[model samples]
Target: MSSVDKQLDELKTDVEQQIPNDITVTDVKYEGPELVLYTPDPKRFAGDGELVRKLASKFRKRITIRPDPTALTDTTTAEEKILSVIPEEARVTDLDFHHDTGEVVIEAGKPGMVIGRHGATLREITKEVGWTPEVVRTPPIESSTVSNVRNFLKQERDDRRDILERVGRQIHREQLGREEWVRISTLGCCREVGRASFVLSTADTRILIDCGDKPGAEGEVPYLQVPEALGSGANSIDAVVLTHAHLDHSALIPLLFKYGYDGPIYCTEPTRDLMGLLTLDYLDVAAKEGRAPPYESEMVREAIKHTIPIEYGDVTDIAPDIKLTFHNAGHILGSAVSHFHIGDGMYNVAFSGDIHYKDTRLFNGAVNDFPRVETLVMESTYGGRNDYQTDQADSEANLVEIINETYEKGGKIVIPAFAVGRSQEIMLVLEEAMRSGKIPSMPVHLDGMIWEATAIHTTYPEYLRDDLRDRIFHEDKNPFLADEFNHIDAGEEERQDVADGDQCIILSTSGMVTGGPIMSWLRHIGPDPDSRLVFVGYQAQGTLGRRIQTGWDEIPVPNPNDAGRTSTLSLNMDVSTVDGFSGHADREGLMNFVGTMNPRPEKVLCVHGDERSVQDLSSALYHEYNMRTFAPKNLETFRFK
Candidate 1:
């Protein structure tokens, strides 16, 4: 070993000694001039920034500390590190700390590969590591370009803020009314149902309903922190009402906390469980990208403590004379349709938080009846009639056909799906089909946070569909725990097992293929022509999954290295998709829900749809319900009642 290697080993031994027995050294290695050490427990050296400084002092060289490579372990290989800095997830390849210059370097691929869209990665990571990471392009690596790149990124950040300002101004102008109002802004997610952020303001309280990611055809639309919505001067908001735990609706909650919104986060029991799964994963991804997550791990724990869990149908007062109630949205296990009895009937508004029109295998459809409210805030995810009639049976058959075809050809089938909603449904469908011998029984691998989230789902059987709850309670036949399924947690050996598996079915997360174990699995399987990569969820633009889904013959994936960061693995898997498995109701479903409303909402605000989707849905709902409808642009406020 060279002097660097010797130092790394010595440092590893020192850290190993310093770390309590509970924390293990999963790996240690030299990356460029810096000695990087990864420990199983991130807090093993907490408040030990001094220890790190001392360690680097010994090297007379720069050094960095990070969570152990194994700390990011999930169902896939140890290579992919879901970043722990930003709200979104990305596959991080390599991390470098330059001793000579005190610069940290990060290399990622695709859109997420960059620290974050619009400098979010750099800003977030810098806050976390107490140092800024300079991101480098994949391959043809050169340090000389750092200054030029930094200038360019800074320019991009400024441009992004300008755009948000323009959008915010337009939204505010369009939405302002003589009376206080509420506006729902849609963020479209390509692979899954889009999310919406609701801005509700009275004379006193200003609340952002659900601030989450809206999937777009590409990577998410740039996340511009809406400064106006954050409020200026004394007109700050009171609290945020989280519609549910879905990422699109709840992922950005930390940013609020990060920016000093000292308010309560309100949601339901299952939503809380799901939020735990999402927020933890979100932080994990941010950390890996060399950016600090907006909220620290401790903040997440603290935020959870402030989560005021409300029961469905119970009217709880958030402020003087302002009561909030949650009705089962039936879209996901713990999702709700929110009713805000705001200010003495001046504004009786309801937000349909991604409601489902029809019952699913696991949950009831959205509650059809509610007190007749003046303003109805709804999701237009399937706004247009284009997706009115997706044949679920056909989609299920397609899943089987794709799986059988891949298996018959002696290849593995990898399904990239959402951990909470999509994964559970897919598992049930696959399990039932296998039980009926409709498809061959294979080694089914669950390689994402799905199993853990599913375990949490079990804690709230009352919220699930009656049959599923009955199966869990009486028959003890938990659909999520079929005997054929194997849970893959992060570890060297299990990842090797997955990579080496000859024929199998594997499911993983960051459903849009933004990050998670799926990337590593894709790296290993994508090169094989026989391998089938099926996407059961939506694919946003700029994501590797979308690139592949759009028929890109090859794509870059993360290959983790012990040296510091990671490198790209070229992916060339046979890709397929099944849109029917989507959790959101389709176009007809949206219209049906609107058509069924009792005293009929006078005004309909359609959000959570793309431009095309929103426009189409708005027109259709008008024709069907004869309700005045508007698809408000982002941040646009609207007058109600």
Candidate 2:
């Protein structure tokens, strides 16, 4: 028998012997990193939760108890039982049943009510319906992306199960060789801040981290020419771990699936949904610009089919010899700092993907604590010596001052922001400012994918900081659902009306002014001396946003009337850049992260910045901590063991 089969047999025998006789064990199977036990009487253990906990502790694995397929109630009966069990005040939005796993998903506006006190309601529902209940929060604003993703998974339950089983077998496969040495290949985001990709390899396993794309660059995708990434075809890479949903960190993932990569992509549940939304929007923006996207939507669907959503802090085996864990990165809704425990604790490495060490209104600061870390790879996006930002309080005050100043001038405010992180941050700031009368109450237009992205954020409130989560969950106060924010969904005509009609605040995407609805707004407002153009996020070098900040008088924009024509617009708007709104850690924050890390690392590698910023941070680390430090460039390899 194969080693994996033998392992499964041993696990099954142990579980059968340990579980109570009342709970008949029908079968044991691997579902990705989890070992699921099928029983006819799952309710028996539901009341005694400690039984499953003890079993998990004894086996040193994640254990899931599910009702056997034969034991599940019919869909109609199960739905009826679920509704009767849940309170009417819960306002349940939708119920979906997955037959392969015997899981019924219940989406409701008030998830806490559905869960009940200490999960009593869930336990009762499981006992009565013979189906495990998974509660989801229905966002106040409807998100088509969330609906489509959930529906697609429901439709492809059987296919997803097959993919999970395949991945589980690979993860549990026998180890054949010694992990004598560990090496990392820097494929992208080393001396520059886009297309962040890295390959971590040992003698027995290979893993890819953050396969992204660089916008407005000649070479858009990561440096796949390295032998560690695509040398033996896409399938050679065992798994892909995403840090967040930013385009620079996730855009090119679908391309991997296009080239026959069927391996599981590990990420937070929010990251999975947000990345899907952004990638689809990427295709739309490319089509509007008359450019052919690297991959088609079919590849994106394939990617979704193969993704395995993991919660933060759950250590799961992605390969036979490597275990991965994720920590909150405090950059965006689902950003994470990935920790790799390779070769049964032979070595430990942590990759900080776009960390913001200071707490923002949207999220708590990045986590600095880890069990063990010998080598640390971190981003240095704002790591220059003079890259310190204003405090959050001061930044907010300045933003309010700017808004009021522009309002008094009888001019509109145009802010180019990233749809995922910066746009949401600005929304909170504006919502509070307007509510408190710090700034005049006016329409805050959400253009491009900002509305859809904001809707996704609302769906995952637990990922937000404690204060924000409590307000949304307990107080029922969602700042994103405020009255002043208007979702501009009526296409170009509505966007044009917002730009030309009134004095309001506009938050549009392609944060750097590279493309998207921001371009249209800029084209209309650029020559208006009364209007104010405010930048609240990092404008990458060579982007039009940066060019405008550097005093570019005239800019060329695509003519709306003609397909292959351009028009030059003179820049006369008042330009201002507010500091401290960036998601990346500035120099001081980056330094503090290393200094405050638990059991400080022995070596440090600085990445994800411009040439000077990476080098400056590496030098500072070497001098300040007296540690071995390096600023690696693309395609460079470093051995840790």
Q: lDDT of candidate 1?
A: 0.65
The models' CA-based lDDT, in order, is: 0.65, 0.88
TM-score of each: 0.68, 0.97
For each candidate in turn, give its C-alpha RMSD to the true structure in angstroms: 19.8, 1.5
How high is the lDDT of residue 7 in model 1?
49
lDDT for 290 in candidate 1 is 52
Q: Report the C-alpha lDDT of model 2 over 83-199, residue by residue, as the tens digit.
A: 999999898989988786788899998998999988889888888878999998888789999989988988888899899889999999988876478899998998888999999
Q: What TM-score does prediction 2 earn? A: 0.97
Tell me the spans in candidate 1 whose CA falls farther than 4 Å from its real position.
Answer: 1-195, 214-228, 233-235, 490-492, 562-570
lDDT of 1 by residue, 1-641 (tens): 54434644666787677655775666565432234565545444433445555666664434545554333333222112325553343435566553322345666433333556555555445434434356643321122222333333344544433432332222112222345544433333322344456667665556668767654332343233554366462126556788888777787776666667655667886686577668778778656545455567655544554456777887665643246889888777789998888766666778888878788777888875767577788787767658664577888898988988988998999888888888888888999999999889988888868777666656566788888876765424767667888888665468677768778888888788876777777777878888888988767545677778888775555545532255665565677878787778888888878888775788888777667887888888888778898877764556553
Residue 541: error of model 1 in Å?
Answer: 2.8
Instruction: Give the top-scoring candidate (TM-score).
Output: 2
